[model samples]
Target: MSWSITLTVNGEPRRVELDDPRVTLLDLLRERLDLTGSKKGCDRGQCGACTVLLDGRRVNSCLALAISHDGAEVVTIEGLARDGALHPVQAAFIEHDAFQCGYCTPGQIMSAVGLIGEGQAGDDPERVREGMSGNLCRCAAYKGITEAVLEAQRRMGQDGWEEAA
Candidate 1:
């Protein structure tokens, strides 16, 4: 039986018909919607490679059933920017060299955005690292990642980042 799911993705409302209820949000976003920024690393929830903002919270898309999240607002890495400007996290990531292979950058950036939006990314680097522990980078860019989050949090504060959240 096909199921219909409506999602406001990256500020655009989209209604999709799911051929199978087992399809994960990641699959639906990538396969059906052509939003491929959220990667499928482990295909399990262990890795945050498929992280996305669901209803303003960071969720592992791989673990979320598309059919269950009808009417939810989802934000992927592709949606983090405006006209020609990068999101604070994305800009900070580049400034801090937070990515090496770039495979986990999307998830890392998304998680950072959510963390800052949640008001959890304080000035403490350790706290930022703890909050971002779910996302792992095989390239061992933890230092840069932590630095980027802290920097982005500070920048977001000055730029009125609440709307992006």
Candidate 2:
């Protein structure tokens, strides 16, 4: 049965019609809403490539049913930047060269954003590593990713981000 859900995506209200309740948020964002930043690396939750912020929390979008998150505020990597300025996490990623293939960058950025919001991504490299363990980078860019998250955390406070909410 088809259903409709009104979600706040990237601070904008989005109303989507779903033909299947089983449809995932990843598909909804990529197919329906055209927010393809969240990749489809592993459709299963094992890969954090489909990570996104849902109601200020990080979740594997591939495993999240769109209907289950109706009315939730969703934030994708595309939504992170505003007014032509990159989010701190984004800028830090660029500075640290956190991505090689760029396939997992979006999820990494989103997960880093969520990690910061949850007050878990600290200046400690090990802490950031543990927090971001879910996002796997085949390029083995863990050093860059860890540095980026740490730098972002040091440079910006949780309040500096609106999309992370």
Model number with the top lDDT = 1
TM-score of 1: 0.97
* Tens-digit lDDT track of model 2 for 1-165: 788899999989999998889889999999999999999999999879999999888999999999998999999999888789999999999999999999999999999998988886467888889999899999999999999888888788644655443
Error of 1 at 137 (Å): 0.3
lDDT of each: 0.91, 0.90
- Our tally of clashes for model 1 stands at 0
lDDT of 1: 0.91
In candidate 2, stretches whose alpha carbon ends up further than 4 angstroms from where it belongs are: 158-165
The alpha-carbon RMSD values of the candidates against the true structure, listed in the order shown, are: 1.0, 1.6
131 in model 2: Cα distance from truth in Å? 0.4
Model 1: colliding residue pairs: none
For model 1, state the Cα shift of residue 118 in Å.
1.4
For candidate 1, the per-residue lDDT at 23 reads: 93
Measured with C-alpha atoms, the lDDT of residue 132 in candidate 2 is: 91
